[model samples]
Target: MDDRHSRQSWLEAGLSQLAARGADGLSIVAVARELGVTKGSFYWHFRDLKDYRGALLQQWEAQYTQLAIERMEADGGSALDKLRRMLSLPAAGAERLGLALRSWALSDKEVARTLKRVDARRTAYLAGLYTQLGLDAARARTLAQFTYHALNGRFLLGDMVPAAAQLDLLLTLLTAPNDEAVAETAV
Candidate 1:
């Protein structure tokens, strides 16, 4: 096999390593081995491990977060439609990568900062979609938080994820207008 891997290949192998063994799997040696090359090959692609990790995070954000949002925006659907399409993304794989990144964040400040930015961006995007659905600013932000957290939590739940019927009900609650009010009897 050819040993001279491109920078993209290094990033891709790093992602695979991250997914397979969490943050601990992201060392230069491990990624080099994954690419069937020596650790020295990593220097040709990255200045150091910090640089490599930064590039990996950048690649992750560009591909998984930015591209998905771009496509959904281009699709031009209703808020609920776009939300459903976007929400389906977490369920379509990449859970391991996300979990690994989060795990890495626990012990690394840079990773934590990057993860925080990514999460906030994703949550803001969800809030934007919810706002488009006619929710007030506060309500939209709150529901977006719930929906975003729940989507991530669903992965952590493994087989404990709610049934389709249960999820449909939650979806309705999320998408429906919250204008219903109880009649005041004492006032």
Candidate 2:
């Protein structure tokens, strides 16, 4: 492979290993073996293991966060609809990503911190979006935070709890209204 493609292949191998095992198990030799290359080739692409990790974190965060931000911004719909879609994405892609990162976070502080920062930014943006949709500012922010935790938890527990069913329960809880809405609808 060419230099650029070789580097990308190394990265892909590292990430695949990360997903299968955890970040703690990631190693230059392992990556090299996976890619059918010598460990020396890994050095040609990255300065060191840390450099490889930094690059991986940057790419994962930027790509995932940008896609999420774009989805939040592009759709012209009820905030609830947007929220539902956002919450629903886990079964598709985000959940798998979150699960892998969460496992990494348990052992790697740098990865954990980076993931936390990215997650906070996304949550804050969602909170702002929620506030625009007739929800009280505090309630909106709380719900936004809850959504992140819920997604993380649900996906982590996916082997035991069905994703669709868990998402439905979460959606119902988040969208349920206050006493006034209840009384007002009581004809």
Candidate 3:
């Protein structure tokens, strides 16, 4: 809790606040108080609340989506392995922030647009992975949609189901051969 704070620190504080009290509670004054710093410290990093929010969104995009994709791509594994790795990645509090952002999106056009773009990027990445696993384009897209939907559903539901159980179901859907997967899962 130093007087001097980094932009990343401010963003992290913002996400934590977003999780605890929703977007309405996310403000420079609140975050500054949370960090035991002055408003000047927050202003040092961002031009204003709007600028802070934009940076926060960018950080969320990078941490939640772009970094995940990069890690999957860099892994030395087959498409199935990569897919498994991506699915099994730990939430690490990002899920709560994501849920908060989605809720905020319901009333904020800018947040809605950003969430839409993030979803598109994520689904496109999943589709590409399915394609690399030898699925046809249509099948890949379908699987991508299903996979992304399941992920967001889990977040929306606050993961009441155990993590192991959810992963088992997701891995079964994602790893099984296409025809067999459809037949077995009745999807």
What is the per-residue lDDT of model 2 for residues 1-187, given as tens digits with 9 covering 90 to 100? 6653387787767777776666777898888878777898888879998999988887778767876688667876877677767776645444656677887788889888998899888898778767766678788889888877766676776633447776566555565566575455443
Q: Of the pair 2 and 3, which is ahead by lDDT? A: 3
lDDT of 2 at 17: 75
**Which portions of model 1 miss their true places by more than 4 Å?**
1-4, 159-167, 179-187
lDDT of 1 by residue, 1-187 (tens): 2535788888888888888898775689888877788898788878998898889989988877888789889999898888766555545557778888998889999889988888888899999988988888898899888988888887766624565676556567676675342122112
Q: Flag the better candidate by TM-score, 2 or 3.
A: 3
What's the distance in Å from true for residue 109, model 3?
Answer: 1.1
Each prediction's total of clashing residue pairs, residues at least 3 apart in sequence or on different chains, is 0, 0, 0
User: Model 2, residue 141: displacement in angstroms?
Assistant: 0.9
Local error of candidate 3 at 107, Å?
1.3
1 or 3: which has the higher lDDT?
3
What's the true lDDT of residue 66 in model 2?
71
Instruction: Identify the runs in model 2 with alpha carbons over 4 angstroms from their true place.
Output: 1-4, 92-100, 159-178, 182-187
Best by lDDT: 3
